[model samples]
Target chain A: MNSNWHEEAYYTIRTYEIDSKKQATLPALVKLMHESAMQHVIKLGVSVWDLEPHHISWVLMRQQLSVHRLPRLGEQIKIETYPSGYERLFTYRDYKVYDAAGELIAHSSSTWVLMDTVQRSLARFPGFILEMLQLAPAPELCLPRPAGQLPKMEKTDHSLDFVVRWHDLDYNDHLNNMYYLQWMLEALPDELLNHGRLRAFDIQYRAEAQWKDQVRAEVQHLPNGRMLHRLVRPDDGKELALALSEWE
Target chain B: MNSNWHEEAYYTIRTYEIDSKKQATLPALVKLMHESAMQHVIKLGVSVWDLEPHHISWVLMRQQLSVHRLPRLGEQIKIETYPSGYERLFTYRDYKVYDAAGELIAHSSSTWVLMDTVQRSLARFPGFILEMLQLAPAPELCLPRPAGQLPKMEKTDHSLDFVVRWHDLDYNDHLNNMYYLQWMLEALPDELLNHGRLRAFDIQYRAEAQWKDQVRAEVQHLPNGRMLHRLVRPDDGKELALALSEWE
Candidate 1:
């Protein structure tokens, strides 16, 4: 897909954006995607004024991102985004990341929905939405599949439980989505988390948890050298999330 | 507002939960809240069995909370949350926070919206949602006023424009929300933020910002000894956020 409807912006890499590992953190990437999306929307002239009096806000439902090469400390990166059009209820966008010389480092696709703030309903795409999107035809968004699915929930046997801590919260008072991926990986033994590399994984958020809640995480190793993970509440046996991870 | 509900849960504060200022960090609070809410939902019968197939997720829309007194490091806080009924579009929940000795520390109100994960649409309340949430009687949610609007955007009237650094980014790519508050407080003349006592104020998240994005923050002294702060993207002249801060 191709169209003239495209714009490019540049951002500098800052020291604070890097984590203890000295790499840009995944949460930072999530934040970047959000800001970039907003910038794209603003370029389309859909400011807060474009929404109805009732408040219109963007809510992240689910995201699947892949990082082939992470930018190093003090390295500058350029991120480009294009509207890939919409699926039934979601507007799809694709992103291509490059280093200073334009070497491809990552590619991603995200689905977004417009919401009615007051009625708390899914808002239909206003004509201005297209206008706000300033749609430009772009290459189809092709994201790499994370590792395949592990067996059913019963297959994963060993499990761990943790109490929700005050620091685990976000502005919304829920576990930040990216934080869960960390927990999903952290549940693995130190040998796996420390030496093993995260080849790929798929995580599905099942329910929201709050402070002081007890959460249970279960893990299993497959003969194929992959691990299956699940998080739940042991007291009532509530499953919070599930993921299939492969590491070396 | 008073509550007759006998809800009780103890949250053990962790060291990571404390910010540079030695206070419970707000992002951590958000994570705990997510766990708490999920536990509540599970108890209401919305289990993994009911959640699969349809990927559904909830994101915070808006929240109003007041902190009377923040807990010291390692303090175990008890937080009680009860449904406060629904407003125009949000499922409202109210929280009562207590210190180890049972002294009230803060009261907060939060609003949330559910979304269809794959479709990324504003998903209406599932049939079981109201039933599940309504298990507890509606309690009073004392709403807080918006923090004083940040003073009008100016050329930093003696301020600094910071390009967000990597370290500043959390798992979420955009600058951490708490950092904004911290930045606002930091921009204040050392005379203020360095004070020993923390009084009260309410802040709201208007939008997310990116790294290397130049932020211009302006601080003005309000007539009542409070401060008005505005953070703006100078390159595009867009207001990223605003805050009204008061201190003792």
Candidate 2:
């Protein structure tokens, strides 16, 4: 087996993956980052198919992505990912996206947890799984780990209520992470989304949202020009996700 | 160039494309069919890129899909498409999807109209465009042209109001055809969606739906075990689209 831990994958930005600005959407970029991570693990022989028999699966805990520029439609880009390191009850991974010219376009870091699918509880990492990954030496990341707790703002400048639809649910029976970013950005003023570009964003998932849940997205424009977003279930007042976005 | 008008393309169903039943969603299938048709037109040297300089584009007017079975996740399927014919103010195309075993899974037919993007009106088809296509003899299709007018049912058994979101808008600056199906099926009773599979469906686009438009989908259960759906804008009382769905 190769000692090198990093794996690379290439993707073409499809028209459907782009937004009205003709730039790739945040959800599309996140999907590429996720597929890259999956390919990396599959290269290590630890794919979801490999773990299914053990009744174990990997669940994303938190992710932070910083973009230099979003790719445009029909642009071919490369994604490089590697297992960074492990912390208590969480595994770390890092991703970097590059344009055709090898210029860095985006960088992201994510934390994942192993879960027992049947019991719906956190599961301890198996030694064999760790052995297969052969985690690379920790490298400095462009962005720091997402903050555990975001500061509460005085007032929400914009808010919208969204019903979790069938299309929002993934195979895991929970709302996909991309929708969190969608709802967050959707709540922003049209002037911002239409004119500006997303430069940096981080999301911390606190709880799983299921189908038919009414999610309320609230956003506050901070004094620093950053946007703070919170997605909560109105029924139980459960916070589903929190995010901070910076635009250029 | 060879005179053969038919074209074939292959697609691998991705995990994200499937629903709870592990089968491909209607939108994914429609996307594949649309992509296949685009590729076919491009091969004939009349792609959107080719038409952009002329400020002209092709817009879907109507489509009917009949499914023998929905493809499953990770399944490789073949899509065959060809220009069937051109009638008064409309060009017709047909598509067939086959599973790995070469068994027909679904078949679809669509009608399109040329649009003058700058004028926002239908344009008369140019003779050169027809010359480029070299339309083959019309092939027998599994489904006929979608009815111009769906019957107005007496009462709506289920109804839901949906606001057009940013994600719902495609490059055309209108609601994607797939979302029309999604919202229509979404309004159906859970018993129909969960216990039955969509066998045949047809939709006719009457008007474009813009972002933030408050559209209501009303569905009625026909005595023949079919569901009739109509989407209309409450503000102007204009019908956006009409659909009829058969479940097995």
Candidate 3:
């Protein structure tokens, strides 16, 4: 039985929680929500051993979250999550984030897909996981998908290169998103982010690159100053990932 | 040719940069230093692709950094790094971190190994890398060995479990050290981190883990209140990493 049940699990907020708006950053909030999901899965006893070698590890395919209210720094909040079943290619998980007084602050849902680690091939959820985690079949919850397919590159006229560093590799021995974002943002013309602030960003992971691999991320500057960034595989023209960022 | 041989690079400090001492944390500093190294390599055209895939990859086997001072919130720092040369089992890289006034605040050197990513084996640096990047042989430069090993864990009877998340994974889909440190620190029984402050912490990476991997970290408390923490694979009980944290 899951020991860390809802009646026993709770998380407290720290003074360092707020963003420049004096509210929590979406990225950080997403992190906490993800943590809550992990806690829930652990409570259910689903672990690493259940993983298959062909396991295409789950990646955050897409997420849609809406905040009815924002929690201030130092405000203790509670989170509850539940499995909402799977679709053709994605497993859905839903969350409700609440403040101490039991007021709902935000509600979110995300889609994830398991992929073969080495081959980078997509994989279906294993039946054992579905039973071990007690993730019973349920009707899929509805949420809006990210608009359009990822913007394509018209051309690769120029590129910026980046080296893989030891610290750059995480426990999975791949690059971290924040640092990857940092590199992509840094590669952009500084004036763009030099005095500006990042409003929102959405990135999709396409493939994994190893430590010390030489990578060239190409950027396409649109007329409006927004950018479509592609992290490319120089050995093959495989587009490893795409990122879209908006700044003001 | 490195076209922007002298073009200045920039980075901003966010609130997350501060550690328990309210100073820029060492791991974060190492991350920034690594970022500087990547930026430098990208500008030099030896970015990721120039690397040999199977036989050679860079692993930060060890690092030794000395900081004369630390940066506070809202601070912007500039950094520069270059390849110093190679030693027997490691490649040496050096860095200079400066404040806004161009005052040098930190000087660091790190030792990295060329590894085979797929087989998890070490490889020798290929000759083409040195030639293509116009790097000269300077085997004299080497990273100073770390002062001590992670204190051995004597508290084998105790264990703490944590759920892993997406934010915990970096671009390569591995958990970042900062998050591991965050987990280790956060797991400190609460009474300690809340009452006292963390003075210093040094840890070493022994192995890498994937996303959703359940981790069990054990801490050995000394009579004087110092702690030795060890993270282990939940199943086979292999030591993943270890750490020592001093509190006041």
Candidate 4:
């Protein structure tokens, strides 16, 4: 892979980004990854601003995030990102977060699909996008392409209903992906949140949830300390997203 | 007053901080002020971490924010803050936000109180805190002292119930002040939110809301495009906060 396709940025973990443990929260970590990708694409001349005139926008399809150790508040961390490669309908990107000591703290791999905002449908990746991205296949995979399908739980342990708020809607006028992880994590028992730390998260977005949409999140704890979370539109029973998390 | 008493920080408006109009949202602007205050206190050797060991913390009592114009997304802004003065039991601080061209976009004046976390009661300012802060009273104020009493609305135009989410709780274990503004603005009618921009916000915090608490926010639109917002605990009808906002 060519190194020119990569970009790096530095950030200081702010108090708002930390959880009760003073460590970065899962959603905050995911935000860092997204920010890194945004910065990287902007540098590549294919940012949202560059695509808006074309009525094109990028959307996340799936992501697998693994944490070695979460960075703490006030810590300076470096986020590095690169385009891994592109398949027929999906483009892959990878991100690595390193703490002040230059130790890898966390990494994530995500798949994205191009969308036609005006048409409200999936669109083929324009050749210009691929040309601008200049993606080169990585020599090795960090994590197996997020499981194609996360198993559905036959039993439910807990559930919560949420009305998508204006803040939850992003510039794209859809619920941001990070909020899915947030709602799922919030549905867990307090015992897990208070005592355990998130180690891994694998999530897939199935459908878009617009502002004011009612979402129902259900969670089922697995025997192996993992949790399966499914979010659906209560009115239509249409699945919005599926996530599996490992906590330690 | 010594100029050293003042501190300034620069921030680039992030995508998540903007509203549909592409301008910084009211809550995001409030957050910038909060972040500026936090940074200033930390520079003075009295950050939250410094007081945590003593089981004491800082809390916002009242804030009066005035906006000339909201900054747009991606705009670089400078936030300047300093201790304005201190009265009997209230410490006053002020903030001014300027756009990249040095145009003042917004300014705020706030009064704060020290709290004893363990006892959950208002506490007197420790002498050491005052000594460390080295506050020099500003020669002028940006806005008048927040009205001592905001008139109770006789009629309500809209109301919404919100169960405080985990994300709403700050490091202090109480609802963050910005979220109060968010909930209030979210409760406004779509026509108002889509057409008007916030001009001023005068808010007073009376009580704290804990996790899972049901908060009902009531908004009454005044004749002058102003709004009176009251947040209360539905079960006991205890008012947590009251806010008055002017829109243009």
TM-score winner among the candidates?
A: 4
The per-residue C-alpha lDDT of model 2 at residue A199 equals 84
| Separate DockQ for every predicted complex | 0.03, 0.53, 0.02, 0.56
CAPRI grade, predicted model 1:
incorrect
**Which parts of model 3 have CA positions greater than 4 angstroms off?**
A1-248, B1-9, B16-28, B48-55, B64-70, B101-108, B131-148, B156-159, B189-201, B221-227, B245-248
Report the candidate with higher lDDT, 3 versus 4: 4
Better of 1 and 4 by DockQ: 4
Once model 2 is optimally superposed onto the true structure by TM-score, how far is the C-alpha of residue B67 displaced, in angstroms? 1.3
TM-score of 2: 0.91
Worst lDDT run of 10 residues, candidate 2 chain A, spans A138-147
Quick one: ranking by TM-score, best first? 4, 2, 3, 1
Cα shift from native, residue B186, model 4 (Å): 0.8
Q: What is the TM-score of chain A in candidate 1?
A: 0.69
Q: How do the residues B1-248 of candidate 3 rate in per-residue lDDT, one tens digit apiece?
A: 44443224566554345443335655566667766665565556554433544345566654545666767644688877666665565666667789999998877666567677777787766665554323522345433435566556765534566544333454344565555555565456656743555555556666776655777777778656577777877777767677777666
Residue pairs in collision within model 4: none
C-alpha lDDT (0 to 100) for residue A182 of candidate 3 = 50
In order of DockQ, best first, we have 4, 2, 1, 3
Q: Per-residue lDDT of A1-248 in model 3, one digit per residue for the tens?
A: 43332322355543233332335545556556766765566456443223535454556665545666656644678877766666666676677788888887877666677767777777766775566334432344434444456677786544667655444454344664445555555456645533445544556667666665667777777655567777876877666677776655
- For candidate 2, lDDT tens digit of each residue in A14-125? 7677776668887888888877776667667787767889999888878888999999976899999887777677888889999999999999988888889899899988
Model 4 quality (TM-score): 0.95
Ten-residue region with minimum lDDT total, candidate 3 chain A: A1-10
